[model samples]
Target: MLKYYNELLYFAQKLVGDKEKAKDIIQETYSKVLETQNKREIKNQRAYLYKVAKNVAVDEAIQNQKLQTAVYEESEHLTQKHEQPEEIAIKQNQEELFMQIVNKLPKRAREAFILYTIDEYSRKEIGKIMDITSNAVEKLIKRATLKIEEELAKKGF
Candidate 1:
């Protein structure tokens, strides 16, 4: 098992994009293999491990999509319905300020940051959605954060 660790990690990361999630999938794959209790009966342990890792990654991704959908639905019902005019004006001003900051980001970084902060997506999920690697997603987010902070400072916020 240890011999195949590096390959398994590479394969899982290719499929899932997130290093942490890939590691979790690898761990779960091992747990599933252990659960069988008939290791001697298997002929191709390497192939079996890969198969388990694929299935686990797919299952986790589907579960994550469902959870994101549920959270989005719940948030829809939680928005404040009644606001004083003064409060509404203030909120609008804040939104405008935020948008100004966000607009200053590079296109990729803007999308990543919005998906991560406003849409509540994981870095891995954001990578999948953006068709980029998780490491790329992380970089975009970091860049976006720095840009936003700089903009806020310039605006005396």
Candidate 2:
């Protein structure tokens, strides 16, 4: 174990992306290996140690990912109204410009684009809502996007 200390540390560090966490994983792996009841039946001690290290590292990574996801969700829940004034202003400007371009679209194209983009409607759902076929929804959305792109280009956007 002493011979493989640095090597195991390097392996765990590579797997976990953190030195302190890797060290803890290696220590736990060593403890688990030392407590094994069938030590004599092991064919290769070094290989067994590496396998244990990998398992511990994988478990640690999974736990860390769950913890990070939970923390992110909690923070998002706690900060529902945390938008900065500058960000709000920029978003409003972009939304206003998008609405201006969208209003200039042909009536059917405008409806399709709004349903698809702003309302987050699927093409089939837009078809149901717009009383048109799904293929027509696709074509209208595509034409609206192209017209918006051309308008933005004309405005040096």
Per-candidate clash tally: 0, 0
For model 1, how does the per-residue alpha-carbon lDDT over 20-124 read when each residue is reduced to its tens digit?
999999999988977764645543456667778878987897788855654566476554643422235445656788898898788999999999999999999
User: What's the true lDDT of residue 115 in model 2?
Assistant: 89
Q: Return the clash pairs for model 2, or none.
A: none
Alpha-carbon local distance difference test for all models: 0.79, 0.78
Score residue 95 of candidate 2 by CA lDDT.
64
Can you give the TM-score per candidate against the true fold? 0.43, 0.43
Q: On a 0 to 1 TM-score scale, where does candidate 2 land against the true structure?
A: 0.43
Model 2 agreement with the true structure over 63-149: per-residue lDDT tens digits? 767656645664765433325322343456566777799999999999999989998999999999889999999999999999999
Can you tell me which runs of candidate 2 are displaced by over 4 Å? 1-88
Residue 117, model 2: Cα distance from true site in angstroms: 0.7
Model 1 spans with C-alpha error above 4 angstroms: 1-87
